[model samples]
Target: MLSGNTKFLQGVQIYLLSRDHSNLKSDFRHGNGKIMVNCIENQPAAELVLGKHVFLSVAEYYLRTKTG
Candidate 1:
């Protein structure tokens, strides 16, 4: 039942979260952190698009949990 904008935002959040934590290495942090940091550093446009999506997903989750 999400609106178009809401859906787009959810998608973007999913994408960003995936990129941020997709690769897990050791407990001390190594390659995964670097990969996410590099992505944020190199791709500004993508980050902007990603930032929009994060909030909406949280909102949607809140709504669903509240009602259920």
Candidate 2:
């Protein structure tokens, strides 16, 4: 387990605070028509997941740093 640090928590807090999900759709709808038989084309969900991954990567860097 990584050591508990206030800076890492602060970073996560900032990341979470920057989100604006008011315009996000709360349902699944496929792109290129539903006839393609593929996963739903959820742009908001995709962006949130991608952003979370990027945040986690940056947080990992801080965790691995000496001064963190």
Candidate 3:
């Protein structure tokens, strides 16, 4: 997460407000659980896994902090 003073982490709900999903995913994947992803979008990133009709981008599963 490249925010001012916020640290992003897995399992943490963030409001992604970017149109650059590819860049975000790439940044998140570059680190080995070191990068935090934060979203300021109208939708919550976690909701993709919590709600119906959710669509996950490529490599999203690997970025998830939790696995069930």
lDDT of 2 by residue, 24-44 (tens): 112112221111112223211
The alpha-carbon deviation from the true structure for residue 15 of candidate 1, after best TM-score superposition, in angstroms, is 0.2
lDDT of 3 by residue, 1-68 (tens): 22343333222423333336665445444643234333444423332321111224434444453453
Best by TM-score: 3
Report lDDT (Cα) of residue 9, candidate 2: 44
Model 2: weakest 10-residue lDDT segment is 28-37
Ranking by TM-score: 3, 2, 1
The list of candidate 3 runs beyond 4 A from truth reads: 1-15, 37-67
Tens-place lDDT digits, model 1, residues 1-68: 12455545455455556653323223114532222322332333332312222322566557756875
Each candidate's clash count: 0, 0, 9
Q: Pairs clashing in candidate 3?
A: 8-36, 15-39, 15-40, 15-41, 16-39, 16-40, 16-41, 17-40, 17-41
In model 2, which residue pairs have backbone atoms overlapping below 3 Å?
A: none
Pick the winner on TM-score between candidates 2 and 3: 3
Off by over 4 Å in 2: 1-3, 23-68
CA RMSD, predictions in order = 9.5, 14.7, 10.4
Best by lDDT: 1
RMSD of 1: 9.5
